[model samples]
Target chain A: MTFRRDRVAALAVAALTAGLLAGCSDDEPDATPTGDGPSASATGTPSPSETAPVDRSREVVDGAAPLEEIGTTTGASGSSFRGATFTFYRLDASPTSTLLVWTMTGGGGSNPQDANYLSWELYPRMVVDDTEYRVLTYSRQGEDDTEVPGAVSNPVLRLTDGTESSPQSALFPPLPDDVDEVELKSPWFDNLTLPVSRPG
Target chain B: MRTAAATLAALALTATPTVAGATEAPPLPTVEDVPVLAQTWVGNVNDDRLAVLSVHGLRRIDGGTVLYYSMGTPQDALGDRATFSAYGNGNTYVFPQGTNTLCAAAAVDAEQGLAYGALAASTPTGCLSTGIVDFATTAEDPERAPVAHVVLAEVPDDVDVVDVFVASQLVQGVPVEDGPLEPTVEEAAPAVGTGWPSVDAAEVAEADDSRSVFDLQSRVKDLSEDVTTTQDGEQQELDLDASVLFATDEARLTSRARSVIADAAEQIEAAGTSGTITVTGHTDSNASDSYNLDLSQRRARAVGRALEQRLPDGITVRTEGKGEAEPIADNGTAEGRALNRRVTITLPS
Candidate 1:
């Protein structure tokens, strides 16, 4: 079935309406996906560097929904299950102090009719600026218990501000602190171009 | 007598069953062949294409003359799923839910890297479960990747039944030291100490700068146009020329950029570790430092975007704009300015 394109466009338009946002030019000595590919001549046995890219593509395809634009205003303020509701929040941070804060919320029982399956992910992408940086991602659903998988929902991207820097974690790797903007996509939302600042 | 013969043929057709229990004794390998399952790709947990059912890893049916197996990689999972095509007795085969992790682990075999194993969630039986092992039938199409099929003498009870869930890039796993990235290499080089005839170990050691003999030859070819070695231990350099493209007013890649980018991607794939490409952009002295900086950024981004879109994701494409800082030739001459306003791409060591 088709989703509303306007909703998706509106979010990005709203973000642009709010403010400006922005990685690295390739000529830099350190910026490349290295220490990644596997050694080629070892043996016939498969290696990780040889297999990482293939696996990465499979993950994107498996989680990816059909590329159709859609509107998503109602879920931004509605309830997820009859009890817990979803909300959208924002933050601005600096490059140090490490006091980075991020917020994620949604409403109306994430019941998309088109979903054949469900999943939560901590996907990461870099804006490619030259600034050195790191980012961390996790769920706070059940913070009291360390062993349990948190109940928090999916799709999180946190940027470092001038004072508070991003942290390194399994999900988000090192990225350029000079990222102008961040865009994240999942079955969870129509568009993920949300700016950290509100519109004037 | 003819009627009796016809009766005997009918009996032969109706004699056996098409499926068997997991505990049942496996059929004799020499007399009748069985199917083997192979992994083609591994992906995330919520993949639907991965969910679409196919032939399970193990197959055993009493008196059945057929066997089936399948395998593939992540790039093949364009739509989120891969395949396990098999032939012969296409009937029910038991799939151990827990053993699926074994397939996941296989994709992330330590030699490959953690990224492969990292994608898969923890399986119930723990890591290193004996994955599916049986050589039943080969896949139908050559395009359908070869399944890692190993014919087993007997079907084991605790067989791993993982399907190829995700797919990553299917880059040829040839070593960078093997040959030139611009010209693909497929010759099976003898590994060190194999001592095979005509495969000299001393030849590999002679090229000290390169990681292997294969790499030395590739680097020598890349550095010189018509590279040749002599007993004098001295080498001569030849003229090496390559081409780049630019727009009329700007340094941005034009429509014709695809061919150049395609050629670069081929080179990157062939280069192996050298696939990591660093693209540096420059501009003429016509614009302000600030404007030229921005312009060069745009041009480099354009190249980076084009390379990422055209080449396999494994090839790292990095872009930087030197503005008017570094000039190949003097910006005074139109010919020199044209050379200055260019993007130089370098493959990593």
Candidate 2:
């Protein structure tokens, strides 16, 4: 009986040793790289590309330059609102319609809804067939339509001050009759371009 | 015991047909279908300020009809063993207790809608203290904006789970003096030195900043006639860019513009001659002229109040507004409309 019990104890001790060795082996750190370099996780970073701009300038398309050449201004004008400049162009017809295309700079970053206000303000104007009209302005994918999902860029506006009487109603004029070729002001107006078609 | 046994046998017999019917049709997986291989618990809460309830679980298998796991933890102990499955565009989780499958589907739909609607996250895991999470699209790309929020709470035995709540909306705004208003535009007049020239009461007609006053006479140094010939004894153009704010319309300044105002304050002080400055507010054509005018004045006063709190000694500020009648930009485009919205500061001009 004593011999049998001693043999049983020896077997149990051997089994315990084997189990310990197996557990330790399982815990050894993995040698192979676990993460997929770029392919591993599904999460992707924000795309790094320039956002597309709304074409509002006039020099590059069909038809002659919309207006006669005007002079240019540079340098700080010393007025309260300085660093301002203007270009002049005359329409063949008596321009009843006028559009103001201007740009503003120096604001920091912008909110998701109003990205156009982020850096610069582009205000443009045009006149066709004597009736003034204002261009509708909006950011890419913003409230005023032009909804591009992930775009982050300022908008260029083509305004026509259509007559509706009061300041409140000035923007409610009928759309412009027809848009002639767009004109461009150098430097500032470099990339700000817009395709002018017959107003809808 | 015999009656109990009989009832059990009857129940099993009744359940067998439904189980068999569910298995009769072979399930197929399509591109739109997600194949889940594990059990999941779906969790949701009807009210924000309460503990989220973990619904029952579902057994998901590739090419297999989903099944609700009848066996689960108790309602009081849902956290002990929870499971989750991925389907549709997001995750569906399982609770300790048996949950209604329909409820789980509804919860998932709600989560995804809320996540994408306001541009939030679709997943709940790895939440920030703010409870927001980020999710990836099917193309393995992250979403445009952070989509969802998850919060964890511990309730004592006596507390009701329904009482715990969480906030789901996030708003960003900066305090501004008044709502947007149209600016007035008038011809520019000659000025003395760098300051505006003394004006004749008869000629003063305040205009918004809408039409920029461009005069050839002003640009040309004495080339043509005098910039302002004494036409009828006296003349002054107020050319005031004034607007109003109402108590009801607490126009919040855009986050960016608020910083611009702060910078303006600094620049004004740097220009010297500081004692008291004036801030004016304005309103658009949205209210009665008289009421709008009053509101504009009040809003200007409010701007003064805000400036007083932020500005230092040496400058005392005054506030006022002119509503409706005066406008600069045509209140049409968002840009022009925003341009109309403003708080103007005059430093001894």
Candidate 3:
């Protein structure tokens, strides 16, 4: 089994898009991600103080999908789960089931509750071979009732497929013997490929 | 193993076990003799590589480890600022930034002018801030950022260092690192986590470090390099070059000197109360020792008396005349000499 993760920024896909736009010049304003998220704004950029030059190799020129580098877009799975960047990790296959992991992040949130609200909205889909498998799963990140000033979680969303299960469907088996990898898809993120290995 | 498991089984059968009773026992999250390290690099606004907001988690398991990070900051880069980030059990979490009036911790996190502070929503740090950036972590989204600081992850078996990360920048707990690993029977057996360390001592050291960060950025600079304040613990060190505070050898307060001193007084008051204020005057080693000492003492007394009038009650303002004894800068060059000839104020800790 072969699985190649897209080593994108550990930030939210939305922030990557915004960072893509701002990548043109390291001259980004001190504008924060918390306000509204990834602005394609002429907003003042951060001080080019110690910033390295934009590594164009990381840039997705010609309008292709974003790469692991900044300015690259996550691959699409023909669903709402397209155009976001993430690090595809984990493919745990058991005698009875499999688990897939992917995490998405964003720039700073405008408010403290934004990341929690975002986490609640994130979920993943399981695709085995060419068929889409249905299994209920939860986002890896969450929030609690908090009241502190100036807290920033580069807003992260962790994706996993470990806890999901399929009913008695032979065609859509949870851990088919011949299947090599399963694509983890989300409406809010891109499709990440992961190879499956049975638990020891 | 059977004894403990039997005890737990009995307890669970007798009454509802607390949620923590069912921790991922050792076999499931196997502990390793060798710890894991998560490398991180925080960059200046212009040259950062990763968009890591803060550390979410860091731990060592039988297989691979968990390394999590908070994803974003309000600004572009994280350089030389207080950061609200935490790491535990191989996970790293970045908290929210900015002064949150609506937050219960806002007053505390933004009071006392602590240089840098981070509170994970999961862990409540009884800290207050009054500096450039201040924040606490919420378990979930809408991360707020007030200051900036960064740390690359490393070794988790040393839970002390990990705890330091938590006390300095973490709120509570940490993120979990979940990656592709071939699950082994080795991890399924119950195991206890390593003995943790005292976070209280780490908190004190972390507080001092936070104060220094806050102090460097807290000064009022009418002229870029002339007047500045740095803090260590409860002591606020105000440095004003004698040239800027006086005319050559004159000790009478200059207009600029008075302004800077007045601002320092305000900041001193804001930090805390009922502390001693030490006013020490210094001069370049150009004159006789006796002459310089007398002059320095007179200058120190002058500043002390002036502060005595401005400062509120409870703060005991005193004078120390260290003439040519302590040279912060070189006395050879004109610039260094100017720096050496200055009035120093040390606010009580």
Candidate 4:
């Protein structure tokens, strides 16, 4: 009776080993996260929606996570050198416009970085009805338009939604009706593709 | 003290007007109508006092009459954060680098009252120590002039400024002992030497130093008779809001933009085609650096192309797009944003 029970346990162990082997794939991202904070789970198929910028006018999914993994492919990620994860977080959106936000999380270095230390020239991009529109950033609220913070971070961007003397009234291009995709991009950070129009 | 003889000579000339307004007018020393140079002050303010390092020129404004100053500091000044404040000053004023009430000590060459504006630091609250910014009025008619200027109307006609000292500390002035009314053009020049009482070397070196801003009326005492004398060249920049020129993000010139280009083309032609005509397109800080740089360049090229068609054969037209790098106004406010989105067609004189 003891020998039979031992054989049965051995069989069970063999089955578990096969299952684990079947799940193993060469494409799997590494388990260890790189960089400062908000470590990425690093364990899922790369979402297709992250390939392109978000089209907020397209029916957005309800109760979706605000964050999306952005460019490692766009050549704008720290992940190329260090295994850092770059993400875009959508905070809000208007009918045709979306407020796109982003952060670079998990890089190699453990050195302390001031929130204001990081600086980049960032702005919004959108395509509507086959015509592309670029929004001119009014300011990081510069001294005048020319002088911006030499050092800064916490990059926030949005469409110049014209509302009573806001920069949108004059500087920003009007949002198009038949919008395709809205995006925020910077050379320093990766291109942020929002989670809009989820594929079936 | 250096201007004593010049002041008396001017007084004698104005007080005793001969039939001939002669002397062919000392030839109005070439005002240059343009800011010859600008300097920024490099010092920090501490314990309610700003240390006076060497002063640097901030640039010139108001028909070359008003000079602006920037005090340089490794540490930022209270009002220094407000960079837009410079464009907002309507009646030619100075932008004290980063200062507290330290520059508020006003002084006038009792001989010529306008001298007060040069050395003193006047705040938006009229240098009154009030938390509020913005003076009650434009002409320091009530508040004396702030920092230096090449040409300022603040100098009174009949008066001659012999000396300058802190206003409250000293009670005496160069007394006007019943002089003439309509001072000659030579007499009109206000004698307010660049007043830096602390450093005797700077005081002695005032003649050659660019930091030493002479009164504007005095600077223009001799014109070579060939200066076009227009305010267009008075400031280094001539910027036009982009909204008035192009469609949202499109670099293609709108009809309205074309019209503006035509008008500007005429101005360029009139200004003389001796130097290269640089057409630069600039955008506000709304987009990424790469994107902004590309768009602005494209827009500038478009304008340059159009101007090329209209320009005279020999005028060299160069177009460059300075993304969000070159801003002339504050981007914090709407009005400032509008000012930032611009296309400037610069014709070198």
Best by lDDT, which number? 3
Off by over 4 Å in 2: A1-200, B1-248, B251-258, B332-335
CA shift of B30, model 1, Å: 75
Measured on C-alpha atoms, candidate 2 has an lDDT of: 0.24
TM-score ranking from best candidate downward: 4, 3, 2, 1
Per-residue lDDT for A1-200 in model 2, tens only? 00111322332343344233322322211122122122111112111132322211111111111121222333123221133333221121111212221222211221111212221222232323332222221112222332211101112111112110000000111223344433332223222223232211
Listed for each candidate, the true contacts retained, as a fraction, are 0.01, 0.00, 0.02, 0.01
- lDDT (10s digit) by residue, model 1, range B1-349: 1121122233235434312111111121110111112211121112122211111122211111011122332232223222221110010111111222222211111111111121111322221121222111123321222222111112122322211121211111111122111111111111111111111122222312111000000011122211111110111111111124555446556666666666555655665633566676667677788787777777777777886786666677788877776543335434335545666566654
TM-score of each: 0.21, 0.23, 0.29, 0.31
Model 3, span A10-128: residue lDDT tens: 33343333223222322211221122112121112222232422211111111111111111125344422233244432344433333332333222221112122212113344565
Interface CA root-mean-square deviation for model 2:
36.7
In the range B181-250, model 2's lDDT, one tens digit per residue, is 1010111111001111111111112211111111110000111211111111011111122222223466
Candidate 1, lDDT over the whole model: 0.26
Model 2, position A74, has a per-residue lDDT of: 31
Compared with the true structure, the alpha-carbon lDDT of candidate 4 equals 0.31
DockQ of all models, two decimals each: 0.02, 0.01, 0.02, 0.01
> All models: lDDT?
0.26, 0.24, 0.34, 0.31
Better of 1 and 2 by TM-score: 2
Candidate 2 differs from the real structure by a C-alpha RMSD in angstroms, to one decimal, of 33.5
Off by over 4 Å in 3: A1-200, B1-227, B285-291, B330-335
The residue-by-residue lDDT of candidate 4 on B212-293, one tens digit each, is 2222100000011111111221222345558877888889888776766676677577766656878888887787888889
